[model samples]
Target: MIIKKIIIRADASIQVGTGHVMRCLALAQAWQDKGGEVIFILANKSTALENRLLSEGIKVVYLLAETGSYEDANQTVDFAQKFNAQWIVVDGYHFRAKYQKAIKDFGIRLLVFDDYGHAEHYYADLVLNQNIVVNNKDLYRNRETYTQLLLGTQYALLRREFWQWQNWQREINPITRKLLVTFGGSDPDNVTLKVIQALDWLNKDDLETIVVIGGTNPHHEVLQKEVSNSSLAISLQRNVSNMPELMAWADLAIAAGGSTNWELAFMGLPSLVITVADNQKAIATELDTQGIVIHIGWYQQITLEKIGMVVQEFIYDQSKREEMSQKGKKLVNGYGARHVTSKMANMLS
Candidate 1:
């Protein structure tokens, strides 16, 4: 059965970050490939991102209301109705229980992309928590009987670009020399600068670094200047399209504990994770405990010395890096988006 159209309610900015929008794009791409139309209702605006979505032939509807507010939900429902959307997918931490109820009140089928079960309650037709550490069913125990739970890494939503690299093999070097640093789509906290500053402590001529900054990043100028003046061999990449290639080329990664962690893991790249936000804590901790990554605590608490020490340790310990790489690859097989889309198709049918 053709699923018709799906309405996605998600936003992106320096403040809210871009994970929600990107992941939604992944699901939208899967649905689009299956002969379904996708429409996005966004509360905030990012011209570059909007253009990117438009480039993919997806419709973008700008909503002039507070994110997750009653008005926002109303606007979303209006758009969904206009498009004759078969399902509404909502992502972003700001979209809470009230927002879910508001959409459900319209008698619309809803899919909630959640993290850590932040809502006071769950009322959506489906709830997807794609984090590895989300094992406790009690988190969603308050949900409605009809609310289906799609938990764990199996449902991790990765974009179509990543799918091309699934069969790609990663070569682990005996010593770590190349590093990829990505602090999510919007490093509002400018943790990328701190990570770059910390690289100064390494003082290794052979060390090569690649730093990726999102288009919405407020500190791009500062970061570019820092990279220019730095003694380290560093390349600053903005809004990169070839992430999988970069991940494959790097021996290790210094990344924010966000959605990119899953991508890194899928690429079998051992990484040092820094929690830039509270939402990222669980991901960092779980990956650390599972030996898939080295957690460096919160971004605010981490110093240049701490970052240097971890990098040095990883560089010297080839065996440890190899182990982490294998563990990470074993954790995420990179077929999550396809799996999720298939389930969504079945649900719609």
Candidate 2:
């Protein structure tokens, strides 16, 4: 039997962050489980992120074409044809409507992962937006008739490491102390420093935190210096392969409003979210309204005082944190990646 192959086109860096590629990695892992091959075509120059993919036995190809240009689509389609890939997955704002059409016109099945409706018109066979949108119908009303949308938290794709924690129960502390802080794979704004300073402001003797520094994060040395001088019991970890263990260990989290929130939710960890990107604003707002997370507003507008105050408030609110944890687990079941891969397999069959 011929091995089915999937071509994934996504990029990650300090500017774009790693949400697109990371979520696509979840899908890639799911496909790999089914004995399929995965190839990543990236326009990013992140050696760290590329190494992570390479470690997973996935092929990585750098794209020299101008980002969001017609050549980018051409190169992606060219790779898909060369491999005789069964599916082409495109995830990024740069892979807009015209780009989707170009891939579909080549008669290759296309899967577009989106957070917001960045595409003016979606021409992919499947458009997967794993974020909670207020209205799915309005988001893609101009999509192709054959395009099928997989929207909301139910379809949130989580990495393979999070799968085993689906049934793990968290023992919430009466007063929260342990904290996990991560701003996706690239904290472009260095929002983490604000959080660290805020933690120092708290001045609690028992407070401990594990700050995960992403591989693509350029502000590492600056952050390292800041953490080294801090009085709080904060540890800096980079390129963490055991995120689920950290999630399981933490009593609460202060994270960016990215795909990592879904993993935290799946692990039933209550969190305070800060929107580091424009696309995350709506999702964070919705999650806050649902009590899935405590949305602390945009990173730019958020002050160090505000972060301190929110953490303080959450530390005392045992009932609220417990509720958030339960609601979070219910929102994401950890099988979304497998579910999506099953759908893709069916489509291929």
Candidate 3:
């Protein structure tokens, strides 16, 4: 038995989003599959992951956090000591070097999951940011050369289901009626509404809109109410389980340039993506430049008119749409989860 206990500290909700929690969960599941004890040190505040963790039967310790303080780190240190965790994985962007340094003396290996490379990371033994085209040379300049850098979607920690569903039928002839609009688990910026309003130009009778919202989404009630009054046949989903099927069935997707961007790419679903945050800009630009997906700037910059125009262009042009779809399928085969997990396991042994 490895007998190594891994502890993950991450948050889930509108501000934090489900992407962080979901990916960490996938990694934790992989760790457990390898016969390692996995513990999640999560925030006490209400999050979508709270119920999910309880259901999974993973040992969890809640950290009562305070704004603008390192109190959470102290709490986590005590919890890790009690659990005898050998590895501590930090997945939140809010954590600074000071927070990481505080737990360094505990003799636990540090793993930092980052996308935004804005802040300096001095304490991480392993750093994983699976962005498609990251400025690795620039971002990792100050970090120690010993830091194991895991970059690109090949190291993307997605669930095993995506890998199983990789061999999807190529959408040779798209109907352009079924559409999926999902902006992370919790759309803090209300990007879903913007996309929904933009799709009004399409024929309502012909289009079927599937809007996936998270349980912790503050705007969930608002989105559902708006969808109820919409002319199109809209399916308002709350934390759906059949995401792979939904993405596979959709003719096109309108989503935030986050983790789901890769998921859509894996499913060969052509997309019109908008940047929900600054960290997502690089991958969004890379995907757009590669001719895989249509890039509309951030929510503030992209208007209803621009979104509608882009959708119309993609919908009417069969050759262009098909070309993009083919490129997307070819880009990622959805073996990312297995690849990432195998790498993590290899690192351990």
Better of 1 and 3 by lDDT: 1
- Tell me the tens digit of each residue's lDDT in model 3 across 221-282: 88888888788788789887778889887888888988888778778888999998888887
CA deviation > 4 Å runs, candidate 2: none
lDDT of 1 at 103: 94
RMSD of each: 1.1, 1.1, 2.2
Residue 313 shift from truth in candidate 3, angstroms = 1.6
The residue-level lDDT of candidate 2 at 69 comes to: 86
- Candidate 2 global lDDT: 0.89
Tens digits of per-residue lDDT for model 2, 1-349: 7789999999887888888899999999999999999999999678888888999999999898998788999999899999999899998888898898888889999999887788899999998888876364788888999999888777899888888777788999999889999998889888988899888888776888999988888899999999999888999999899999999999999999889889989999999999988888888999999999999999889788899899989888999999999999999988888888898999987
Worst 10 residues of 3 by lDDT: 166-175
Tens-digit lDDT string for candidate 1 (68-150): 89999998999999889879999988789999999999999999998888899999998988899888898899899999999
Q: Which ten residues in a row have the lowest lDDT in candidate 2?
A: 130-139
TM-score of 2: 0.98
Clash number for model 2? 0
Task: In candidate 2, list every pair of residues with a backbone clash.
Answer: none
TM-score of 3: 0.92
